[model samples]
Target: MFYFLPLLLLFMTASPNTAIIITPNEHTFRVHQRAQWKILLPRDYANPFDPDEIAVDARFVGPDGRELVVPAFWFIPGRIESEPTTRVATDEQLRQASFTVRFVPPVPGAWSMMVKVRDTERTQRSAPIFFEVKPAPPGSRGFVRRSPKTSHYFQFHSGEPFFMIGPNLCWANERGIAQYDEWFEKLTSNGGNFARIWMSRPNQLFETKKLGVNRYDQDGCAFYDALFETAERHGVHCMLTFNNYRDLVDRDMWGPAEWPNIPHNAINGGPCTRPTDFINSEIGQKLYRNRLRYIVARWSAYTSVACWEFWNEQTFTNVDIPPAWTRDMARYLKSIDPHQHLVSTSFGANSQHEVWAMPEIDLAQEHQYFGEGVRDASAPISAMARSLWEKFDKPSLIAEFGIAGEGSDIKFDPDGIGTNMHNGMWASMMSGSAGVGAMWWWDNYIDPKNLWYQFYGISQFAKQIDWINQRFEPVTLAPIMSDRSQPEIFADLIIRSAGGWGKSHGKPIAVLPNGQTSLGLPQYIYGTEQPRYRTQTILNVGIPQPTKMVVRVGKVSDAAVLRVVIDGEPTKDFAFSGLPGAPGQTKVERHPEGKWQAEFHQDCELEVPAGKHVIELRNEGNDWLAIEAVTFRSARSSQYADLETYAMKNEASGDVIAWLHDSESNWFNDRAKKMPRTISGARLNLSVQSGKTYRIDWWDTWKGRVIESREITATGGGELQLEIPPVHRDIALRATRIGS
Candidate 1:
């Protein structure tokens, strides 16, 4: 972290002379809120070669007497040296020379700060000014923070899960803000806490944003100030991208048509003759850095700003020296900004370029859009998100993903329920994304269509669990095939336990949020602190008849208590028990420290009757356990043995539940299969302990209400297999284990 705090340079460098005074946003602020002040330096105090001497400090002494000192960087006027045309001022006259000192007090207190500026002669410190910092209003979490305990998620300073659920409001200019406000209001009101805004539109929030370059757009700053204020009012977090790739181009990609308005074109007197050179050009970088400095100085202290995204799809515009440019700009932003917000850059849909892997970025993000022929189902999308998650191993998001836009062959859907918007959110979460995949075309499609409820559904389900504290890999079971005339209602079987082994490992997989499963040997898990954990999975399997059966539970390296049952009766009544593997068990030691090693094997089995049965595998000791494959058998049962359903587990409460849906049931795949929507009797086979009772509950997606509820006993068989009501869109059911 190469910093630019000038006062810290007392042991070093030479000098200059300056007189500076302070202007504060407030003589006070809320805790973790900005306590800002501007330092007006004499215009002649400019020194391009050594700008650090003019650094200003925003100091806050807390009630506990703990002091925090932050450095203020200049919000210099940018210079593109371009031809002055319609909207911008010429370069030479626009050399911005000003300073502002800002800092956030993380604690409530009576704090005093003095403005200080260094010069050739001496250090000038103003008389200390006092201010009071109250605590922020309820629900404000200061700023989004990376989870300290896990690598894949984010939590608020308030420690609540921050699951983002909204689309791109990139064109949110003040020109028609009522729409943007409505969008923001609807989004926040419907559980959306995120938005991706672009600051690139010409004269939107950045006048010389693309064309003239260096000149400061005071109007732009006011626009952004209002933007953040609006976000704060709606309780929404915004990810503002400084520049999007399309802005670099002077015309459309496939043709030679020129955009007369783009000022950065070589014809406009800028250095770059093509979009590629803009990133590599010294003049462009300088102007960009100036803009970055201004952005940080102004918006860095706002709680509503989630991150400072550098470029939107930097790789697409053929930008020269991408890695070097991304690296340099990321560093520059980090150096001048006192508040270290998250940073990221994106690429075209479904693509992960070299830049997405850059360590300078806090979040690895990409764009993905699926049209005709491209599979648009949540499972496939989950796989897409998972693939990135597996490779990046950092906080990740689908910054821009959708099936719209004029250039895209895919047409837009006003009703997003059966569209990507609905499935995409669920898929993003299953694939282990920090927030929902941002759908493109917010104002045009999402708002007017009343599709905000799509987000409400996703957020409601997401709020049920803590993604940051718990790591979950997708739990995949064999597809439970249904007769053509039957309702192919599969079960939702999410692992409701702590920690995980990545999803998918050849047979049945436990996929990591990144859409990947770990190989044998070196392994990484979210529940590293807990030495051991147990899982009592109540699987829903279909059994054609009340025939004899053999049940197999994959073995873990640790000790376990695996059992099988049939309709509340111990399988022993059916005369069945499981045995450990021949080798017993084996675990791969983690590299380096090698303190903890997770073990695995598929050597456990039992015998039970073939009916809708539940399998319960408890633990005798420490918590960690992995059952690679659970196979129920009989002679020729391999053809009959199957697992179908998706699970959602809530750890805050000891409930591990799952939903029932055909792997191919989503509308996207249905379009491909040309499958008709038909209703049928779906069977739910859950694994329960012998002698236990349960309240089997089923929710109907169409009616959005509980359609069925009944109590049934697990008469000691360790399995409760039963038939469910007619399956419409899908079945969301829960078998709350009552008593044993």
Candidate 2:
């Protein structure tokens, strides 16, 4: 009987269990992108002799509603790498279990895998776990080929211009990943398509060990995974920044040291110099290379990645670097991930030429902070663009161009803002700038309520202009010179596209006839004057044949007479006084501002036969005139006409004030004392356009109190609303603000 009992036990243990269970009761594996799929069995078991006695079935599904099959396999402990085994009780019997099966998908995409086990007696299945397989990124499209030296142009998938309207995400604090998603989404919905994500050394992979900051762990990976996934879903591109400008200077600050406690020198201490010894050290180079390699390996497959910016504003501290080092760093990056896009550090506009000389850089990026008026703002930018284009002929981008409305004396001017941004775009386009990225979309990070609305307006306008594929062209208009007489004044005549007439395909020729046009005063200038001021007039000397011209104006009545002189002889004097002229006849239209506008068209009998004609205008008996500038395409010359000279009087003291300052502190006191006090309440009177930000500052001198120090966004003309806080006695108030 004992021999028989032993034989029965051996038979029971040897035979496949009527029921099976798997350890790690549940497991998750990413789908599509080739991840190994494994299943654990309750205990090591052999297949039963009767195939019908054992049943195994598995199925996998993806987030996109696609399903896949999982192959069945026997549980072999030693044959396959044995994972930790576990014991579990099923009803009355206890069994040992081991993991089984291995699966790997060749492609990438999202998926879920489920394994079901059943015997003749019962059926049970492991809980299904979910995972994601990212989509393959678009590597290189054949449409535009990129050379080793030339960088590839990026075309946004949304069918819009490659205009990046966004802000730099430089929050150095440990912001929870959940918060990042919310902020990132808000940016995208608000017209931002790109974000600069900083990769801190202390928080990153290798440097974490030294800094005592945890290295790239599951938590960080999960955060990044969610961030990248969310970005892709929202159509936002991330410019992965490896380090801050400060990191480039003092590498040891974030070096392998007490990391979390490692004070940020840029913040804790003053700006410090880059550790050249560390950078040149073998360990330093190795650390740098390893860090970069890890990042590339982890994110190279992400579609939301725009480009890898080597560092943020590397010139912030003026770190000296040998040419060899620059070449070496560029070469090192290229060697690791040749397919990844790259950008050099952004620098001041003046430093563009020197930065572009770096062989590893794909794009020349620059930052500028010009005031809101077009003419004053465009000069330096134009010069910078032209210089870069003439020297390297590479694509350039205005990486940053912004101005704080606070602390500025300038009032909000829509036309001025539009003109400033437009001029920058035109300059870059004409000077071969592939695109322009607006400085920011939102404002006042500390106070979300103070967000800038003008960013959206300007971005919308930019989309329209860029949609036309208008490239800036250099035109040599004889009488026009590029100069700005007043900070507020600006003017430029550019040919967007021309030469549609010749027998051969003629290139679009753009003529940039700037302030130097033969107008009486410079074509563009801003100044304050009495009720009557001299209006500068410009004349077009040559009217090419077969071309048509139209003139548009705002805020002026009594149209200027257009005198056309061909080859130094007076040919015709056409009067433009309305909209849509009559078959080449000059026409005029009235604007909402009660200003009569005039248009002069060539190609009509009213126009002189085109050869070489001088087109000129003079201000004749018009008052209160304001020209919004002009646009001429094709061969005709357009002139500024009908200058009305009128002075802005304070009315109280008959004083003309070019600028007005307003604020909360002295709201009542300042308003009571200023001229024209009785005419209106306490308010600053200044000519301002809709959709601009005006900054004002004031202090309560009487109480030694600071009262109103904030920005006021102007929606339209008239008195702007101010939130004057209660002024406390015995405290002086000093406040300052700016508008966009």
Candidate 3:
């Protein structure tokens, strides 16, 4: 009979007038649980999404006298298949349309709600409806936010830390919602708690509606309703990116030609005349603001919506997003979102530093893709994340990362080992990043290959660390081998230069018959590392072998000279020329002004002997040469052990976590090697409080469980030494102070 108590209360507070119908999902809601009121409006408007045409909102007054003005979103109810394997709603028929006001009750008490409806001319409000909220269930956490105690890490309203540990489930395939169901199940079951999703273009939300129209698609809205519901069920927090810059362009790495179909194109009646105008023009901003309103109204109530990202790789758009637009949108979003979720935007690797430094940007995100000549993924991943945090003084996230941008690692790794994917997750989390790096290629690689286990170990390790209150600082450790000799660390280093080739020389030397300016090549300038056409790459000698270096060159003027300097030695100009002088010159052509013949697409190689070296590449020619990439390959196997280690320690307490990786076990070398090079005897020295006894747990990364445990007390020098176990590829160690 206790079950009927809520139904009885629902009937008591609701008015006798049948014209205003209100149905609650529960008789009594719990704190942190969604309190939904499905109301059947007497009238229907043609465009419910546009608040200017018609608006519906609910005024909720909590027990603590806090008034929440929440907007009611339109909903077309439908039923999903019971226990279905896939999540497609294609066959289902829609029921009568209604408005839904969803809110998560913060405290346990009596709550009152009133629905207000407004049309073109008049406004009407329903009688106040009453309800009750109970205490939240055990272990239930509220919304996520950047911890006030620490700006770099996230915490729940319940004061529990939130460390994201999942990949990018950007969009669904033909199976629709069912695909997310399967993916989320596998991910969450393996300890994943976060996913990055895109709500742009043909695959997702906005494309289902007419381009440029203020109206939103009902079907798209339904998809998200199910998506959030599924995410909540699986305990996965979602980062929904509103725009994918590729949707605003005619072509991207994905491949394309049809600009007419692009929603942002002027031909589609969008406000922007070109892709670049989307971020700068006044009209574009108006439309974008409308879209933001609809987004907030529809999905802001969900506890699973962890972050609201404005764009995915906005730097890859036709023109980089200006700081003004970033500031305006972020401020606007903060104003509308009642929950005040975290906000951020992604950018191409090392691009758009000026915009990220703004105070409005909550998190600085970097997208990394390793192409040819880059074999080790962990070093660059750690370096880039650390660089963003250092430069911006905010939390950083590697939003999108993979071995290759053009394609998935499946082509190269048919066995589906996912070595880079594994290494990247460990590296980013230990690099003082907000959480694990969100990897790309989810559809073709992560899902199809069934690589969910890669997330397990890190999630297990994260469970033991309190990221918010601990204030962990990142540090590196060097291990000593049992043979009393330093271990060999190999790396296939990649050095990237600044700027592209064939840019205009600003002053045109001549005018063509078609009335176009004939611009000459820009003059080369080389002095220090900051000067144009000159860059430096620094690395310590890890292997006792000569490093193979390759330089990619494009379009060199006749006077263009390639110079290389090593370890303060005299500058040695490579044997290369533009006009029939370079040995590997494949093509030489005159510019539009016919100034001189210049070489195009040439490669220069050099071998630097083993030792500590500072290599610098400079162009001391009359005209510039577009140098794309410089690669240094160093790999050799010896009868010694090399472990790459990164750790984070809490200074107040002697609590710390460390990840150790095999030096030679990169994507390139691991595939070609026959047997696993196992290191058995090694010693690692870590910094801890003097004389503190700490319990150490050694974990098997693949299995995600502690294999062994021991306790050790630090010496007078504030150092604790651990005898390392056998490491096949990688391992993790968690040390906790016994008394602390």
Output the number of the lDDT-best candidate. 3
C-alpha RMSD for every candidate: 15.1, 23.7, 10.0
Q: Of models 2 and 3, which has the larger TM-score?
A: 3
Per-residue lDDT of model 2, residues 454-530, tens digit only: 23433443343332133333222122111123132322233211001001111111222322221111221112221
lDDT of 3 by residue, 1-740 (tens): 01112221211122345465778877879988887788766655655666777777888888999987778776654333211121222312223456777888778899899888888978888999988889999988988888888878888888999999999998887787899999999999899999998887545554421423565555566678788989999999999998877766787656773344645567776656787676777767877887887788778888889999988877667675777888899999888776777888886633567667877777788777765335656766776666566677677788888876778877756677878788888888987889899888888988888889889878888887888888887765544444446554554554433221212122212211111111211222233332433433322333256877777775565656677776667456754456655566767776644545555556677778875555555566655555555556753333234676767778788788888887566676656754558888777778889999999999888788998899999999978898888888888999889985
| Positional deviation of residue 722's Cα in model 1 after best superposition, in angstroms | 7.3
RMSD of candidate 1 to the true fold? 15.1
- Candidate 3 local distance difference test against the native: 0.70
Least lDDT summed over 10 consecutive residues: which range in candidate 2?
A: 496-505
Q: Candidate 1: which stretches are off by over 4 Å?
A: 1-19, 42-102, 110-112, 118-130, 202-211, 253-266, 271-274, 281-283, 349-359, 404-418, 481-679, 684-725, 731-740
| Candidates' C-alpha lDDT | 0.55, 0.39, 0.70
Q: Which stretches of candidate 2 lie over 4 Å from their true place?
A: 1-152, 156-163, 172-183, 200-223, 248-274, 349-355, 370-376, 404-431, 440-740
Q: Tens-digit lDDT track for model 1 on 327-423?
A: 8888888776656788887755323446667777788876655433233335444555665677776788877766533443123342244455665
Better of 1 and 3 by lDDT: 3
Q: Model 3: residues >4 Å from true position, as ranges?
A: 1-25, 39-46, 78-95, 116-127, 207-212, 257-259, 262-264, 485-536, 539-562, 566-570, 575-615, 619-640
If candidate 3 were superposed on the true structure by all CA atoms, what would the RMSD be?
10.0
lDDT of 3 at 258: 33
